[model samples]
Target: MMMFSWRRRRATRRMARGGGGGSMTELTIPSHFLCPISLDLMKDPVTMSTGITYDRANIETWIEGGNFSCPFTNQPLHTIDSIPNHNIRKMIQAWCVENRAHGIERIPTPRVPASPVQVREILDKIAAAAGREDCEECKSMVEKIKILVQESERNKKCIIANGTGNVLSSAFEAFSKPERFEKRVEILEEILSTMAMIFPLQEEAIKHLKSEASMQALVWFVRGEDKSRRRSSILVLKEIISSYPEKVSELGEIQGVLEGVMKLIKEPICSSSKKASLFITYHAIASSSNQEGFTKAFLQMGLVSLLLETLIDAERSVCERALGVFDGICETKQGREEAYAHALTMPVIVKKILRVSDLATELSVSIVWKLVKHESREDEDEEDGGVKVEALQVGAFQKLLLLLQVGCSEWTKEKATELLKLLNNLHRERLECIDSLDFKDLKRTF
Candidate 1:
């Protein structure tokens, strides 16, 4: 047998130190008994669909490395994981024992990889345990799957190969239904942790995760007190929401979905969590059904104050996302009212004009235009007419003027022209009214 160079050196040292009784001898390994990929003695040989047999670990590494063809013949493979070659394994083992004097160690039988059937059986038991009183059985079963999932990539593939990903999704769906959530919160938390560990979920899993029940459950976990669970939940939630493009009004069904998701943006567990939170908010309002209704929900949750705080302190990407959502909020009359209600909305938004990214600038300009244009859009004027007044007070005129001078998108420049015209009209009106303020009986008017 051809041993590794390090192994040979170790044996030589052992013999020199009078520790080994026999000197090592070199032996030529047989060609057929070796793995073609590694050229090493076959240990746990498995045959691929292409009819090529290789050591189990080597072949698995090949397939997992994104190869879909045989290593030696270059033929495409129909099946992913290879089947165990029992006969070759037995012969390899017998040959190892017969060549004991040649320093060959007999390969033990390989443990069977966890199969989809096994995962299905455990899932059935878990579903049955949901009705029973004691959850210890459920916890143990989930814990077992958790361990198997962590064992290897092959195990993860085997476990969720079937539609059992949906089973786990439904298990997480318990959080949405309070009656079902009574005794299963702990179990659901465990399930969240397990699913988080095995991510990049298949299509079947994502289908249910986008369902109303799972979305609600995900929102709860994102806002939940368990810090670890929140991290896991957001990681999974971001994938589900962003991976699927079609969003619907089912978002409106959740009680505090907006509030729960905002918690992530308000106080993120990590950078990714913050981005995911922003992604959820941006995506939630993406549905036309969610716009008028859920924008009101966000406003009720004090989204204006939260967004201003984020713009002041967040990084470029976060600023872009927060501003994106804020722009969406500004599309509605109530959205404009809520923003105008906030003390620093105009001032802070003006600050963002030239400081952040161009997208941020565009979003901020859009919001300014909406707030100022509400008079024209609704044909109604506010009691104070502060949209134009506040715009001037916050140096918004100069910023918009600077944005125009420095140049921007045609859309932004056009909005800036309108904003400058609005601000200038207000400036001229304020100047024109200055002389009347000195008169004793002057009536103040905008």
Candidate 2:
């Protein structure tokens, strides 16, 4: 629509400069260039049953939304068949190339939509190849399926429509069989790869992949030697865990799963894998009934220092997930003690209040709140009281006060105010400098 409006103005200007024929090129796009529905130039032009031409995707979306009438004709459509208009497409491509100097890009030909029959055929091939020792054929079929998935959204819909999800679900179950324990590494990799191809489907398809056997197979892949498989496994697990939080308990039961998760956090893998590991850890620690055992294992795995180091990474996703895991773990007494023992823990947590996103800011405030609350109840323990003093020394007072000064989320504001009050009540004489500097502002707000 914007392009049409611009072309209209340009055409008016061209007509006003009567026969001057200057060096400036005319921007008069053909009237027939636009689609009737969207008013945008058609890329993959298709003729409908009503003899109306529209872009394939736009018309498909219309049909999928239960629109039976033709968009332009206002007539009831007999069928939804959209035959490709090859002549119009070729003309559009030629016109685009001719208008290259005017900043128009040539549209790439749209990939053919995967038919249901073709999808079923490919699924059959994949299923037949899964049982054999030589999985080269299976791998080849998966590669083809991946290409089809990457080609277009229509192909993904077609594959999902043809029950490809069950194929992948079956593959996961087969990979988990005890008899397949001595299988070749290539076969296992291919199975994981096949799942990865369909991993981006809808939730209904993803739900089909949540069996116990599949979960175990994924845990095996997470601890496997192949980096790519490990990466895929972590990503898939992240999606599944987010969708089904109850599965976290089952995932936690697998031996070495937690260790593998911690290993992923410590390794120099991609940020996605690290984020997934952080989420899995967060869910496990947050929902586990045995807080003592979970906290002991987490601290024993050296998550405190690893999380401290991760805070220094500049990626926001990594930072948000790291803080989430950190917040969940710090709820336990052992976790709190471990965090306090880390030299950089307090400083790093305070520094992230405004440096990262608001979510990070809230989590950081919660961590400090929990730490201070823990210390507040332990009046006799000199070591516990020392944490509050250390926090003051590291400028926690100033940071929390500043957090209130700038308008943050209501929760963050409340937490900061509470922490500040705790500090003010504990050491009234020590906070005189900060109070005098911003006393009126703090008094009015609190």
Number of the predicted model whose TM-score against the real structure is largest: 2
| lDDT (tens digit, per residue) of candidate 1 on 265-307 | 7888888778878877876666675578777777888888988
Relative to the true structure, candidate 2 reaches a TM of 0.77
| Model 2 score (lDDT) | 0.77
Clashes per candidate (backbone, < 3 Å): 0, 0
TM-score of each: 0.59, 0.77
Off by over 4 Å in 2: 1-29, 37-41, 58-80, 93-109, 128-137, 182-184, 200-213, 376-385, 398-417, 428-446
User: In model 1, which range of ten residues has the least summed lDDT?
Assistant: 431-440
Error of 1 at 267 (Å): 2.3
Error of 1 at 111 (Å): 9.0
- lDDT leader: 2
Q: Write the per-residue lDDT of candidate 2 for residues 1-446, one digit (tens) a residue.
A: 23445555665677688743456444655757688888788999999988889999899999999999999998999988889999999999999999887678999987778888898898898878765533677777777877888888888878877877677556555555655554644665666666666666456645655777677777888887778989888888888888888888777888889888998999947877888899888988887565567668888989999999989865888899899888987899889889878889987887777677779889988998888888645542575456676677667788787777766788888888888887775664443233333333332234
